[model samples]
Target: MDTHSRSFAKALSWRATGTIDTMIISLVITGSIKLAAAIGATEVVTKSLLYYLHERAWLKIPYGRKTAS
Candidate 1:
C-alpha cells in the first residue's frame, strides 16, 4: 500500500535525478557553476514539494490505482 513515507521517499529520489538534470542543463546554458548550482538547489526544493502534493492529489482520485489481491 502507498504511504506518506513511501511518497516522501519517492519524491526525494526523483528530485535527486531531476536536480542533477537541471544542473546539467543550467550549466550548459549559463556556463557558470554558481548559477547552475543555484538553479538546481532551488528546483530541488520546489519540485520535490510540487511532486509530493501531486502524488497526494492523485492518490485521492482513484483513477488508475490497483487494489491488492
Candidate 2:
C-alpha cells in the first residue's frame, strides 16, 4: 500500500510537469505571460489535489494487481 506522503510527493512532481505544460499552452493561446502564469498557478493547486485523490482511490481497487503468496 502507498502511504499518504508518497501520494503527495507524486502529486507534486506530476503537477510540476503538468503546470509547465499548462503554462505553455496558455501562453500560446492568450499571448500573455501573466495570464498563463495565473492559470498555471491555479491548476497546480486544483490538479494536485485531484490527482492525489485519484491515486488514493485507485489503490483501493484490486484489478490488475498481483499479490505475493
- lDDT for each residue of candidate 1 in 1-69, tens digit (9 for 90 to 100): 579999999999999999999999999999999999999999999999999999888888978778899
> Candidate 2 lDDT, tens digit per residue, 1-69?
999999999999999999999999999999999999999999999999999999999999999999998
Clashes of each: 0, 0
Report lDDT (CA) for all predictions.
0.96, 0.99
- Give the clashing pairs for model 2: none
Give candidate 2 regions above 4 Å deviation.
none
- How does model 1 score by TM-score? 0.92
**lDDT value, residue 25 of candidate 2:** 100
Candidate 2 TM-score, true structure as reference: 0.97
Q: What root-mean-square deviation over C-alphas does model 2 reach?
A: 0.6
- Check candidate 1 and list the clashing pairs: none
